[model samples]
Target: MAVSDECKIKFRELKAKRSYRFIVFKIDQQQIVVETLGGPNQSYDDFTSSLPSNECRYAVYDFEFITAENCQKSKIFFIAWSPEISKVRMKMVYASSKDSFKRELDGIQFELQATDPSEMSLDIVKGRAI
Candidate 1:
């Protein structure tokens, strides 16, 4: 349940500098580590596609869209992706460690926990954004 120092630094870069579109994290031998990073120019589809189909992962997405008032807006979403098809042990680890891991990253506007693709749909994300 250890959070890497790099995770905090990378998250800070993303939130303060808009340096990344998304970040995918995985637990490597019990320590959470960065798995992949999507550049600032990457699309939401790219972020969604980066997630594995049957694995547990934590991610942060810098979401941008136009508000109903025709103003540009952004939100930082913290996501916990735990597919039902993934291993029970993996799910337990992620669920148990989520709060502690999240506490290390500040300025997260929203949080979403998805057990499958549909649960973490684009529409659901937008709903939270609003």
Candidate 2:
């Protein structure tokens, strides 16, 4: 699907913030699905493995994350399951110094509460709560 203009704007704003990492999502039918990509280190293996058989219909890995600087990003990963979304969409928001990345990730848990996947578009942008 084509990305909305609002989502483009929000993405630009997010990039400007230069945060370490963030997850973007959208509500699909009655379930929320990750709108971003995942990789070996960032995969939602644990979460997906724990789901009931009927709930495990989607692919575990839907996106690929690529970065030029590996040393500067955070290796820390977090997992959370909300009835809000049925999948994970964790990703690095920017590439910068290690210290800056760490600082940005420190407060992300709190910020995540404000994210409403229902408001987000399919492209993971143009969300009202973004």
Which candidate has the highest lDDT of all? 1
lDDT of 2 at 23: 39
TM-score of each candidate structure, all chains considered together? 0.97, 0.22
Pairs of residues at least 3 apart in sequence or in different chains that clash in candidate 1: none
- Please provide, for model 1 over 12-59, each residue's C-alpha lDDT reduced to its tens digit, 9 standing for 90 to 100: 999999999999999998899999999999998899899999999999
- Residue 84 of model 1, lDDT score: 89
lDDT (Cα) of model 2: 0.30
Quantify how close model 2 is to the true structure by its C-alpha RMSD in Å.
16.2
lDDT of each: 0.94, 0.30
Each candidate's root-mean-square deviation in Å?
A: 0.8, 16.2
lDDT of each residue in 67-112, candidate 2, tens digit only:
3553333222222223333333321111112223224323232111
